[model samples]
Target chain A: MKITDPRTAATGHRVSLAVSLWLSLSVLLALVLISIAVGKYRIGPGELVTALINRLQGGDGEVPTVIETVIFQIRLPRITAAVLVGAALAAAGATYQSLFRNPLASPDILGVSAGAGLGAAAGIFLSLPVAGIQLLAFAFGSFTVLLVYVISRAVRGHDPVLVLVLAGVVMGTLAGSCISLLKYLADPYDQLPAITFWLLGSLNAVNPADMQVSLLLVGLGLVPLYLLRWRMNLMSLGDEEARALGVNAGRLRLVFIMSATLVTASAVSISGVIGWVGLMIPHIARLLVGPDFARLLPTSMLLGAAYLLGVDDLARTIGEVEIPLGILTAFLGAPFFLWLLAHSRRGWQ
Target chain B: MSIDIAGLAFGYPGHPVGSDVSLSVAPGEVLCLLGPNGSGKTTLFKTTLGLLPPLKGRIAVDGETTERWSRRRTAQHLAYVPQQHDAYFPFTVMEVVLMGRGAYVAAFATPGRHDREVAERTLRELHLLHLRDQVYSQISSGERQLTLIARALTQQPRVLIMDEPTANLDFGNQVLVLNQILRLKQAGITIMMSTHDPGQAFYCADNVAMLRDGRLLCWGPTDEVLTSANLRSVYGVDVAVVEITKTGEHPGKVCVPVMSDPRGRADSEIQAPPA
Candidate 1:
């Protein structure tokens, strides 16, 4: 067998990484444009571009009012929400996987999604406003992870990662049961349907305000992760080895967990419990680019944004009634993930 | 740099693996720790590397007590090469070596050009530059061990603590790794290593410390400390320490295990010819 020189191979790898990054970014851009143009109203590409330009240049009334409303008010916000939620979930998944050193780890491994579901279900059962329900969901999601951290800390003398994961499983189960109870008690006439829809997840009701709030929270979470991205590579090497390499593994893990939870909670708050994107997108990204966290973060985010936006487009265009996002993601994500598993030459580990 | 361990008691919480361990390694010297499995050799190495806090002792590096030193400070002075194990990701060899610059790199920043230069230089010195782009998980175990040593060297550490550097390697690879240790010692870096093979200690170690059942059995110069009696006591088997005086080769000692049956009868014992 012949081996290539490292210098040449490294250069080649760098070129490939750059190409992959640009390719994914371009795909996401194309998807975003397609999503904006292909809604129920079916605005033509020329009209879509004209409407966007007119809106950007301060609305000169050249475009039709209905076109403007559909493009700006409905499709734009939904597209933005899908992108943000997908990126946040994927980033969180990559973070959790690296932190736990397990390929199976995802954003929901720490009970954030279950807690958010329970909170949203309660809010709907009590007939709370949309904003109030989202707020409660975010709070519950963050609090569940905090509780798990505390529980893991209180239990002394064990692998901290193992303990945290075990605690998360226990708490997640409890939260899931509570959500089930809430569902059972809800009036089947109205509240139960609302609860079910929220749990199944959708981008149907997202507005500009919800988009802005999620954008702010997800951006806040990503800044820290982006800045500390290189350290995450050390983190995957295990706590003792990372410590030996001069990283305060315990402190770094806390920061990463908190940032990931923050983004996941905020995304779940706006979009309900959209699953599988977090679990699947990072794996896809890992296959595209090798598992250096610094490179993995951006690649995962871009692919995630493109993937969810594409899936959301399918959900809206495939039928009269919009398909729930959670169902579609599982539908699309599972077989694709299995295919990836079967076809992948270099395993994630 | 010199490492001074005084009355060290080390282990996990609620589980004391070893206690009352005291030893020191002078600058540019190699100290070999010989012990059986479950005899707390790893625990001792972890404690010295500051991965585990000492339960009832003080570890000083160059006369400074290290109990309060941050992990970064400890890493700046001491580097540890853990046993070769499976990694969670397929990071390239260069990336793994670059991780050693973590002590010098700021918390928020990635490795800079200088760090890369250092990593490359270490890899080059170890004859590993050719494999720098290979996935770490795809490499052979011997190469993985060498890459780990290259990583430790990248730390620019004063003292290197290696836990069984030659463990799980074949004969040729073991000698290759031992030669690297000797080269590192010649470069004036203090080294402390643990091993299951007494022949390895005779090969490269300047001094030897034997531990059995959580206690230091003996500590002295390698020739005096690694005697047949000490090896027998530590491993519960009889062994002969023989000196080889082959032509055109440097003289050295090698330990040969004396075969015996379960009934305590010598089955194929070979008597050492009169030296």
Candidate 2:
């Protein structure tokens, strides 16, 4: 009867987890199905289902070519890319916030995005192929994080987290300057547009191959993060307390940083530099399901996937030309952030 | 399990904090470390808990060298209650307590049913079962301290180390925590805690160790080691050890600091009470 009864508290967590999971998963599935029908020529739900069924059944070439092209080619890869990028960034953001004990921390706090941006810029300037550019971007992003880790480890004074953040900022600045130099040297008519588009972050050109690769990397990174979900709660208590509770804070931190960077790099390689999804989605998920990582992880993943998919749909249909995902995310995210600030007392734990 | 330290030296790199500290706490014994601020009490506690590697000499838990033991093994034998518990996330009291089962659980596995039962029983034993669902950050300082203690109890350790458990607590909470310590001692849990109050040493300690400027002033039974001379030498003050006898209670020893030195009057200007 009483709240403090162990049975009540235990079930309270389980119930909230189950309820939020089902609700978010339902919303996510509905959004995915609805988004498939929301392009320039909107397809009805029934038509969309029929097209999917025909495709699955080894089409006898009876399906309309326009319908087949639009559903399978135009929308499927873009929608899948949106969901993967959103989920990856959101999961990475949650891990960073917990690992650093700072709510302000994001996926890019370790300079993965900046390094990836530089790698993309240099790849474009060097005139690398598409696959080569993505590969280079991932490598540079991971390399930058490794350098930051090593520098922070070598430093003797200051808190470890502070040092890591400082190193990231310094490395980020260096990488940013290099990117600017590449832009200055690039041909304004040809390479400049490509660089700008990539930096602004868009899903306009995502293909099946890119989606498959990014999804594989994102899924690989999520395994460790999911397995370490319970320990992630301990990370928020700061290193000393975490260590006192029998955790090797240093090792766990390294594991989390590597996992988060892996997913963030993979996402950026596919979708350029979509921001705010990482920062805003976790906070929103925290509001819905409290801050326990066991519940927060899945909730954030689903909410992020749905939120970005909706935003992408709006980007393509809002006006004549497609708006960049980075721009729309900021426009939507800033207002939501203000609302969060106004209602932070709801539950900021 | 008991803690054994012999000729231990603890400090940061190029900064030696304390040395030659030799002491031991038997099973079921409570050892109160008394010292002024910055006297290396925290450093000693960290060394004993195996957080800081001893600069010299050997430290052991139950006669096993700490260096040979894994962090998890050391945690299994000992638990630490820090001076402050601050977490940014809003974990429930039950969740915070459940973290004590971390060492027992495998790296990739979550805590199981038995682990949760142990956590719940520990919370109930510490009278925190009623507050299990409350947010840890929303709880009072006293409740947070008790929650941390319950967490340590969940570890099922042989020795518990507390760093200033009563620091910042009000009168009632202070007494409440002291009684908890006594109860734990009765249940055969060895405790080693540091405190700023010498009187607290008299109340809960079976033995006492006093440190001043990285050196031990005295170490022995509480009554023999916490006398006026040793107290004055360790704290640089005049203190009288007095026994207060109640009508139907055991006599209790208290350290009364004598602050009547005339030199202290020059800056003793008093403010008049409001009308």
Of the candidates shown, which would achieve the greatest lDDT relative to the real structure? Answer: 1
TM-score of chain B of 1: 0.96
- Candidate of highest TM-score: 1
Docking class of 1: medium
lDDT of each: 0.91, 0.87
lDDT score, residue A320, model 1?
A: 89
TM-score of chain A of each: 0.95, 0.94
On residues B1-275, what C-alpha lDDT tens digit does candidate 1 reach at each position?
A: 99899999999888998999999999999999998899999989898988898889899999889988999998988999998898888788999999999899999999999999999999999999988888887788999999999999999999999999998999988999999999999999999999988988989999999999889999999988988888989999877888888799988888888877889876865664333
Indicate the DockQ of the complex predicted as candidate 1: 0.63
What lDDT tens digits, residue by residue, belong to model 2 across residues B106-213?
888888999999999998888889888877877889999999899888888889999999998998989989999999999999999998888998889999999999
**Residue-wise lDDT of candidate 1 within A29-80, one digit each (tens)?**
9999999888678888899889989988998899999998898889999999
Alpha-carbon TM-score of each model against the true structure: 0.97, 0.94
Off by over 4 Å in 1: A1-15, A345-349, B262-266, B272-275
All models, DockQ values?
0.63, 0.46
Candidate 1 TM-score restricted to chain A: 0.95
Clashes of each: 0, 1
